[model samples]
Target: MKNWFVALGGVLGYFALIFLYTLGAYLLVRSPPWFRYLFGFSSLSIFFGLLARTFHWASVAHIVLAESILIGGGTLFSLFWAFFSKKRPDPGGGAQRSPEERPGKSDSPATFLPAEGGDEEADLPVSRVREEIGTLLDAGLSVLVYGPTGSGKTSGVLMECLRERQAGDAERSILLISCSDGMEDYDLLNRPVPASPQEKARTLRAMAREHPDVRIGSLSRLFGDWDRAEGPLRSAFRRAAGGERLTIVFDELNRSSVSALNLILKVMDPVLGHYELFDFTTGERLSCPLDRLVFCATCNMGEGYGQTRELDWSLLDRFPGVVFMDYDARLEKQMLMDLGVPPDLAGRMVHVALALREAHRTGNLAAPLSTRHLKNWGRLVADGADPENIAPCLWVNRLVSHDRLGFPDKDQVHGIREVLGRTFRGGRKS
Candidate 1:
């Protein structure tokens, strides 16, 4: 009877030891706050229990007492450990600093705000943009501005140049070209071409008088015919460069075809004489210049708009700077206000615009909306048209379906509704 009773007690103790070991293993994997204390106590209990039995302690009561003391002490130690392990708050109060600054230091003027908006007091004079045209005369480096639509990139850069020109900066000159096929040719000249020779002369005189330092030209004029200059369109480039420090702005670069893009890369190559020859009238070769010109190109991120073309890796490498233009809520609101949008309406419209963008990103929508759509929508809302009254189904039709601008139909609105239903719940949470 005595031996059997001892065997039973040993079996119980053995099971208890296994249980404690398993618990420790689990605690190690998860390491939750509460488990820390539980593991510590259980481990100490197992250790004391084993020690008491091995030494043949005086009685069951004495063994139990030892186990309890060890468990209690371990629990106390775990509490102390938890206290020390807690993460402390940062000394800077969790403020974000720019990449260039030290952890606690503030950022510089150029780094802190958007490039368009510098410090109020030290803001670069708008007129300096034109003067800086001469600054690019030597063509130190080509610039690439990558931003979403409505980031004020084209307007900001061009406006600054115009401001400089107005300030009497005669040495600087610029040429703006749009690769987009949708833009009208007359738009390039900033007016319609005259039908009569007399009218044409007048237009030319006005252009020279207004923009004396700058000469407005287009790629179409340089090439004469787009289809004919298929194989390495080089001549126009050579003439455009002409050893002058010229700033060339190429907007909507993604609209250009792959072959045209490659041709551009070849033109930009410094090793090759920074110009090319194109076949002109009378079988003569026309040389286009580019060596002394600063090239600035703009492109959109590939977010499902058909306008974007896949850029070749080699072409991407030539342009050193790629600036990402993201949507800034604060700036968007300010821009809306500047456009005569009511403050309240602008705030709400921006929120909806951001929500729609997020929905598209998450695969809840079929197409991405443009900044122009958001601005137009906000304008309509500000004009006293109820947003809810606008057909919910038309969202996709108006913004996503066709490249051309206008309102959407019923089926399009349904698609938008489906997307909104899946992604948003009253615009409060996603």
Candidate 2:
């Protein structure tokens, strides 16, 4: 009896330890960077202490443990402070729109809010992009907005949806699917997920009903197995068919693999009323209908964007509303000025961006400075960081690759450096 009890306790302890480790790993992966770093530091410190005890290296262990604790603690505290201390800008009032101007039942026209320097109309490109998206939604067609990185393609679609939510469209559901080259067909259809307690109870009840001869207690233990959950694409389709207005946004759509895209093509067809998916649980084909589903995707194509393939015409043909967006220098400059950057400095930053774009076009540089980069540069300048000093880090380093000598690409870096120097001349004398 004693031996059996010992064996049972050991088995339970082993399983409990495994469960804790698995749960910790799952949460650690999704935790923020600073938390991850702190965890790593603690793990390393324990490892070093164990090694030191085995080898009797007391002094070295002490120094290392002290340094790790100080550095890790300081990093964690600083990240916490910065996160809490940063002031968030207020969400200004949005322009009111009547119901006649609304696009679909869920998606409404984006409201251009008032800005400091000028009225809302001054932000032309953003408003125009939003209007275009609203118009596409109104036509009952899927929208695909393609542009360079950081050109606000995704934001334009999101802003339109946000306006709907703000306008009391509570029934609207926005399902965001972030596409990548490694994504699988099953990732977009359905996959096995850990079953919740409620789901397990429901499954147990169903099993009991199917097999009236078996006891529910015996079947309950087997309910620990994972349950299948539909992926975002299938779930959105199901909800839309069930009378819910679903906005499915596939971000970085061009980065998805050919297989994933092919699977998606079946359901993306507007003419096709239904798409089929194999149900392993029921051993049958489940046909899901498409209704009230507004499909939207953001694609980053052209040069400078790696790990992205050219979209096939078959995939492109599914989207009737395709909008091409690019960096708008005028709007970018106005935004920078609004961020408290001096007008002259803001203009010069845009000039630098244009020069880099020209270099990229001429094949002299691998990538151009985007408006996002300009905003960062402008912010740093506004904070009193020397533009010329930080230029190498803020943009130049990003545009060039390290050579065999472990230095930034000599020719490309030199060209960007020249552009920065010329653009920031006498501007940094303050």
Best by lDDT: 2
lDDT, model 1: 0.52
List, residue by residue over 121-171, the lDDT tens digit for candidate 1: 232122233234334422345666666666555665434544454367444
- How displaced is residue 92 in candidate 1, in Å? 55
lDDT of 1 at 377: 60
Once fitted onto the true fold, the runs of candidate 1 whose alpha carbons sit more than 4 angstroms away are 1-140, 147-153, 156-170, 181-244, 272-291, 301-303, 390-396, 399-430
Candidate 1 lDDT at 53 equals 83
Clashing pairs in 2: none
Show model 2 residue runs off by greater than 4 Å: 1-131, 156-172, 194-227, 271-291, 426-430
lDDT values for all models: 0.52, 0.68
lDDT for 58 in candidate 2 is 80
lDDT of 2 by residue, 139-245 (tens): 65788888878866676344554456536666766788999888877777676788888888888999999999999888987666687777777676656656777
